[model samples]
Target chain A: MGGDFGPGITVPASLDCLRNNPDLKLILVGDSTILNQHLGENLSVFKDRLTVHHASQQVEMHESPSKALKNKKDSSMRVAINLVHEGLADACVSAGNTGALMATARFVLKMIPGIDRPGIISALPSVFGHTHVLDLGANVDCTAEHLYQFAVMGNELVKAVENIESPRVGLLNIGEEDVKGNEQVKTAAKLLENSSLNYIGYVEGNSLNAGNIKVDLIVCDGFVGNVALKSIEGAAKMISTLLKEDFSKNIFTKLAGLIAYPVLRSFKDRIDPRLYNGASFLGLKGLVIKSHGGADALAFKTAIEIAEIEVKQDVIRRISEQVEKSLTLSKSA
Target chain B: MGGDFGPGITVPASLDCLRNNPDLKLILVGDSTILNQHLGENLSVFKDRLTVHHASQQVEMHESPSKALKNKKDSSMRVAINLVHEGLADACVSAGNTGALMATARFVLKMIPGIDRPGIISALPSVFGHTHVLDLGANVDCTAEHLYQFAVMGNELVKAVENIESPRVGLLNIGEEDVKGNEQVKTAAKLLENSSLNYIGYVEGNSLNAGNIKVDLIVCDGFVGNVALKSIEGAAKMISTLLKEDFSKNIFTKLAGLIAYPVLRSFKDRIDPRLYNGASFLGLKGLVIKSHGGADALAFKTAIEIAEIEVKQDVIRRISEQVEKSLTLSKSA
Candidate 1:
C-alpha cells in the first residue's frame, strides 16, 4: 500500500523482522484483503504478535505531497504515522513517495519542541564505517538557524544510536576553509562553534564518504544534502555497471570475473547500500524511518531494524532534551 | 608557482602536451629559476615550442579570491591569464587556487557581453561516455537568470567542443518533477523550457553519473554542482579503497585479485578521474582551464589537451554569440 510493491514487499519484510526479533510486534497498515492475501497462513502463526489495520486510501508515487496530505487521509502511510502519533505503534516505516511521507509525517506528528523543522537523516558508507547526513530534501531553502538546529539534532542522534559520548559534527560546504560557502553556511558555522556540541569546522563534500576527515555527523541544507547523496549513489551505480560490462567484454575477462567472484562478493557486501537503507525523519515528535522506495525485502527489513533501534534508544526524548539545553544556553548567553 | 607540485608537475605536463600535439605551443609561467630547473635539458629540446614567462609571485592555495585579485598581480596564475588577455596566449591553464584563478581570469579577460558571471564546467564519466556539468564552485548563490546563463554556456560548449548538434541539456535538481526543487531551479527550468536550446527538463542528482536520462549537459548553481562533483569523486575513491581492502584481506583473496588483475585494471582505466582532468571557466571572454590541484604530469597534460581543443574550436566566440542570440530572443519576447 505504501511502496512500489506495496504489501508484496512490505509484508515479507515485516514477517522477516518479526522472526528475527521474538519480542517485536508488527501492525500491518493497508487494505486488509491485500495485506491478508500477502500474509497468507503465516498470520495464523504470528496472530498474537501481528495484526492488520485497514487503510482504504493509497498515495501514488507521483502524487503531490500537499495533495496527498489533503486528500489521502486514510492512506497506509498516513494510517501508519497516525498509529505512531497515537502511541499505538512505536514507529512507522514507509517506502512511498518521499514528499508525501514527509509532509504527512510533519503535519501529523509535528515537530519536537525547539526544533523548527524536521529533517531526513541517513547513514552513508564511509571509510570509518559510516557518516550520518541530515536535511536530505526535507527543507530545500534553510535559514542559518535551521542548519544549526540540524547539527544539534544530528549530533544527538549519532550519540544515542552510535553510542558515542560526543559525536564530531561538521557543517558541509564546498571547501574546508572557514571563508568558503555562502552566507547561510558561514552563519551556521558561528552558531555551531558557540554551542556545547562537538563542532568541527567546515568539511567539504568529499568528507561525506572519503573519510579524509573523520566527522561522525555532517549537516547541510536539504537541497545540498539530497543532491550530494544522490550523486554518490549515481557514481556507485556507474562503477558497478562499468565493472560488469568490463568483466563480460569477452570470454577471458568472464573467466577472470569467475575466479574473482568470492573477493568481489565480499567487496560488494562491504559497500552495499542496503546495509544503510533506513533514513530517519529527525526533529519529529515521533520516530519514522523512510526506506528507499525501490528497496527489496532485505533492505526494507534493515529499515525496520533501524526503527527498532531508534525506538529502543528513545531518540525522540534525547533530541528534545538536547535542543532544550542548547536553547537555554543561547538565551542565557 | 601554483598547485601542490608547481612546475615540477606543470613543466613536464606542458612538454608532454607539446610533444603529443605538434602544432601546440606552451608557455611555462612561474619563477624563472624554478621553471628552468624543472624544464632542465628538456627546455632545449622543445625550445621552439615551449617558453618560460617569469612571474615574481605565487598565489597561496588558501588565499582569498579578492585578496589574490588585488595583491597577486605578478602571480603565476595572474601572469598566465594576463598572457591570454594580451593575445600572447590563446588560453590559460592552471592547477592553482580555484577562487584566485577565477577572480584573476574574470578581472583580466572580463565576461562575455551578455553573460553576468563565469562558471566552471567539467566533464564527468557516465554510462554514456561523459556528461558536462557547470558552475562547479564558481557562483555560490545564483539567480534564475544566472542558471539560465549557465545552461546557455554549457549547451554552447558541448556543441562546439563535443560537436553535438543539439546536446540534451538538463537542469540539476533534487527531483525530476516540475514541482520539485527551490524557487531558483523552478524559474530556471521555465526559462530553459522557453529557450531554443535542447532543454530536457529537470534531472535529479543521480542523472549526473547514472546515465538513466542520457543527459549531455547538466547545469546548476556553483554550490550544488561543486558538492555533487566532489561527492562523486569521494564515492569513487571509497569504492576503490574498499575493493583493494577486500582483495588484500588474505592470501586466498590476493590470489583472486592477481587472477583478475587485467580485468580490474581495464575497469579502473574506464573510470579514471585523471582522464577527465580539465575544467573550463565558461562565460568569460577568454578560455581558462583549471586542472586538479594534486594532478600528476599525465593528468595535467589532459587539462592542457582540453585547452587545446577548446581553443581550436573557438569556444569563447561560440558562447558569446549564443548568449547574444538568446538575449535578443528574450528581449523581443
Candidate 2:
C-alpha cells in the first residue's frame, strides 16, 4: 500500500521485526485482500502478535501533499497514523509518499505544545559513529523559534538514542564565524545561546561528518538539511561506482578484488546507508518513523526497530515536557 | 600572498601553469622581495612573460570581508583584480579570502548589465563527466529574481567553458515537483520557463551526480549550494577513511590492497577533486577565479589552467552579450 515494494517488503520486514523484538506488536494497514495474498503461508505463525487492518486506498508516490490530505483519507499511511492517534498502537512507521505521510500524520497527530512544526530527524554515517541532523523536509522555511525548538528536541533525541549525558547542538551555516549566515540562522544562534541547552555555535557542512566529538545534533531549515542529506547520498554513490569500475577492469584486477573481498566488505559495511535507516518526524504528538520508499527487507526491518526504540524511550513525552518547560521559562524571563 | 601556503604554493603553481600553456602569461601581485625568493632560480627562462607587481598587504583567511575591503587598498588580491578590471590581464586568479575577494571584485569591476550579484560557479566530479554548480556561497539569501539571474549567468558559463550547444539547466530543489520548493524557488521556475535557456524544470540533490543525461548546470541560492558542495566533500572523505581502515586490518588485507593497487590508483585519478579546482565568479565585468586556499601545487596549477580556458573563450564578453539580449527580450515581451 506504501513504498516501492509495498507488501512485498513490509510484510516480511514486520514479521522479522516481531521475532527479534519480544514486546513488539504490529498492526499492518493496507488492502486486506492483497495483504492476505502475501500472508498466505505465514499467517498462523504471527497471528497473535500481528494484526491486519483494512485500508481501502493508497497514497501514490507522486501525489501532491495537499491533494492527498484532501482525498486519500483511507490510505494505508493515514490509517496507520490514526491507529497511533487512537492509542491503539505505540508508534507508527511508513515508507510511503513522504509528503503525503507527513501531511496526513500532522493533520491527525498534531504537534506537541510549544512546538510550531515537526522536523524530519535522521542520522548519517560520520567518520566514527553517527551524526543526527534535523529539519530534513518538515519546515522548509523555518523561523528562529522553529530552529531553537528543533535543537531542543534533537538534543533530547541524541541523549536517548546515543546514551550521551549532555548532547551538544550546532547550528548549520556557510561559515563558522559569529557574523556569518543569513538573518534567520544568526537570530537562531542568539536564541540558542540564551537558552539552557548545550549550544555550540555554527558548524560548516564540511565538518558535519567529523562525528561524535564535534557535535551530537546539527540543526538547519529543512531546505538546507534536505540538500545536505541528498548530497551525501550522491557522493557515496559516485565513490562506490568508481570503486566497482576499478575492481573489475581486467582478469588481474578481478583476481585482486577476490583477494581484497573481506577487507573491502568490511569497509562497505561501515559506510552502508542501511546501517542508518528510518528518520523520525520530531515534534509530533505520536512517534512516527519514515523509512526510505525504496528500502529492502533488511532496511525496512531496521526502520521498524528504530520505531520500537523510540517508543520504549518515550520520545514524544520527552519532547513535550521540554517544550512546555522552555515556554514557561521564556514567559518568566 | 592570499593562500594558506602563501607565495610558496602560488609561485610554483604559476610557473608550472606558464610552462604548460604556451600563450599564458602571469602577473604575480605580492611583496616583490618574498615573491623573488621562490622565483629566484627560474627567473631568466620566463622573465619576458612573467611580471611582478609589489603590494603592501595580504588579506588573512578569517578577516572580515567588509573590513578588508575598507582598509586594504594596496593588498595583493586587490592589485591582481585591478589588472583584470583595467584590461591589463585577460583574467585574474586568487587563492585568498573568498568573502573579501567577492566584495572587492564586485565593487571594482561591477556586475554585468541586467544582472544583480555575481555567482560562484565551479565543477564537481560526477559519474561520466563533470557537473557545474553555481552560487556556491556568493549570495546566501537570494530572491526569485536573483536565482533567475544565476541561472542565466550559469547557462552562459557552462556553454563557454564546456562548449555544449544547449546545456540542460536545472533549478536545484529538495524535490522534483513544481510545488516542492519554497516561495522563491517556485517563483523562479516561472521566470525560467519564459526565458531563452534549456530549462529542465526542478532537480533533486540525489540525482545531481547521475551524469549528463539529466543536467549540466545546477543552480541554487548560495546557502544551499555551499552546503551541498561541502557535504559532497565530507562524504568522499568518509568513504576513503573507511577504506584505509579496512585495508590495514591484517597482513592478508595488506596483501590484497597491494595487488589491487593499480586499479585503486586509476579509480582515485578519475574522482580526484584537483581535476575540478578553481571556481569562476560569474556575471562579473571581468574574469576572476578563486582557487582553494589550502591547495597544493598540482591543485593550484589546475586552478590556473581553469582561468586560461575561460580567458581564451572570452567568458566575460559572452555573458555581457547575453545579458543585453535577455534584457531587451523581457522589455519587449
Candidate 3:
C-alpha cells in the first residue's frame, strides 16, 4: 500500500517470507499482473496461502500526501490501511511513498487514542549496537509535544520488540547541554524530563554514531532524521567508491584487503541495514514495518524476520495497554 | 582558538600547509611553548616566516557557545578571532567546538557588513561532483532572510573557491515542489525567487547525493545540514566496514585487491573527505575553517589546502559584495 514500486519489491519479499515461514500467509494489495510477474512461476504453489486483491491506482512519489489519499480511494496503500482498520490483517507493510503511506494511515486509520502524529522510527546501526532514530520523515517541523510523544512511542516499541526494560531515550540536540539546541529541543527537553520515559537529556550528532550514549532511542524532527538517514546512505556509497579505488591503487593494499576480508564481512554485518532494515511506524492500531526499497532477497528475508518478531510481541496491544495505564494514572493523580 | 584540540591538530596541519606551499606564512595564535614543541624544527627552518603569540587559556569542547565566548577571555579561540577582528590575521582556522567558534566569530569578528548570522558551509563529495551543504550546524533555526543570505554566501564561496561560474543553489526541502516543506522553506523560496542568485527551487534528500539536480549548493538549517553531514560520515564508515569484509572472504578477492591497488588509491582520493577536510564558516567578516579534531596529517593537509584556496580567492570579499548587492536590491524593490 506504499507506492507504485511497492508491488515489485513486496512480491519478491513476500515470496521470501512465505518460504521462510511455512505457516505465513500474504495478502497482496496491488495490481495482480505486476505482482504475478515478479512472483515468478511458483504462483500455483503459493495459491490458497497467498491472496492478491486488485488495486489499479497508485499515489505518485511526489504527490501531495493529503490529495493523494483523498482522491485515490482504491489505492493499494489506502486499501491496505483500511484492511488493518477493518481487522483483516495483523500488520501492513509498505516501501513505496512514505508521505502518502503516513498520510493515508493518519486520515483513514486515525491516530491511536493519545498519539498525535505517528512517527517513522528506524534502527540505525551505531558503534554501540542498534540505536532507534524516530521521525525518519513523517512531520518535518515537530513541536515539543510531538518529540515527547515520539520518545514515549520509540521507548515502547524498543521495549516490546527488542525486549528491553526501561530503554534510555535521548533528545537529539546540536550539543549535550540542556539549553544547547533550538527552541524545539529546549522545550522538548522539559517535556521529556517531566514524562515517565527514561529521558537521558540532550545528545549531539557525533555521539549518535558513537557507542557511548547508552541510549536505545534518539528522537528528532523528521527533517533532521531524514537527512541523517540519507546522509548515511550517501556516505556508504562514498566509502564503497573509496574502498574500490583503494583496492585498485596497487598490489600491496589489494593484498591487505584479502587478509582483511573476513574481518570486513563481520564489520559489514554489524552495520548492514539489511540486518536492521525493518522500520516500524509506531502508534498505529496494528504493527507496520517499512523495508528498504533496494533490499535484496537476504535483506527482505531479514525484514520478514523482524515483522514476525513484532507481530509475535503483540506490539500494538502493549502500546494500547501502556496508553491506557498512563491515562488512568494521570486521572488518578 | 576554537577548542583545546585545535592547537594539537592545527599546528601539524599548519606545518603541512607550509611544507606544501612554500609561499605560505603562518601566524600561530596560542601558547608559544606548546606551539614551539610541535613546530620547533619547522619553526627554525621557517625562522621569522612563522610567528607564535602567547595565549594562556583554552576553550573546552562542551562549554555553551555564549558562556565559552563570554567567560573564556584569554582563550586561544577568542584571541584568534580578535586577531582577525583587529586585522592581525587574514583568516582563522580551528578544529574545536563549532558552536563556540561561530559565536566568537559573530560576536568578535562580526558579520560581513550586510550579512546576518554567520553560516557554516562544507563541500561534501557528492556523486554530483562536490555538493556544498550550507549552514551546517551553525544556526539550528533560521528566518527566510537567513536562508536567502546562505544562498548568497554559498554562491559566492562556490564561485570563488570551486570556480563554478554560476553554481546552482537549491533550497533543501522534504519535496521538490514549490509548495512543499515547512513555513520557513516557503518563505525562503519566495525570497530566493526574487534574489539575483541562481536558485534551483527545492531539492529533496534523494536528489541531494545524486547529480540529477544539477545544483552546486544545497541550503538548509544547521540542524538538517549537520545531521546530513554526520549521517554521511556514519554511512561511509558502515559501507567501508562491509566492503572490507566482502574482500576478505577468500583468496580470490584478496589477490584482486593486490592487483588493483593503483585504481583503488585513485578512487579513494576521489571520495576521501580528508582531501577536503575544512568546513568554512561563511558570512563572517574573516575566514574561519573548522576541520575535524580527529583529522590526521592528510586531513589537516586538505584543510590547509582549503584555507589557501579560500584566502587566495578572497571569498570573504565576494560574499560581502553579494550580500550588499542583494540587500540593496531588496530594499529598492
True contacts kept of each: 0.86, 0.72, 0.37
Listed models, DockQ each: 0.87, 0.70, 0.36
lDDT of candidates 1 onward, in order? 0.91, 0.87, 0.76
CA lDDT for candidate 1: 0.91
After TM-score superposition, the amount by which residue A17's alpha carbon in candidate 2 deviates from its true location, in angstroms, is 1.0
Off by over 4 Å in 2: A211-213, B328-333
Instruction: List the candidates ranked by TM-score, beginning with the highest.
Output: 1, 2, 3
**Residue range B206-298, candidate 1, lDDT tens digits:** 899995779999999999999999999899989999899999999999999999999999999888889999999998889999999999998
Query: What's the C-alpha lDDT at position A157 in model 1?
Result: 88
lDDT of 3 by residue, A61-125 (tens): 77778788779888877787788888887777776666777778777777678777788887877
Which candidate do you rate higher for TM-score, 1 or 3?
Answer: 1
True-structure RMSD, every candidate: 1.3, 1.5, 3.6
**Residue B5 in candidate 1 has what lDDT?**
91
> Residue-wise lDDT of candidate 2 within B29-123, one digit each (tens)?
99999998889967778988898889999888888889989899999988888998898988888999999999999988998878878999999
lDDT of 1 at A166: 91
Worst 10 residues of 2 chain B by lDDT: B205-214
Specify the poorest-scoring 10-residue window by lDDT in model 2 chain A: A206-215
Cα error, candidate 3, residue A8 (Å): 4.3
- Quote the lDDT for A165 in model 3: 90
Question: Lowest-scoring 10 consecutive residues by lDDT in candidate 3 chain B?
Answer: B236-245
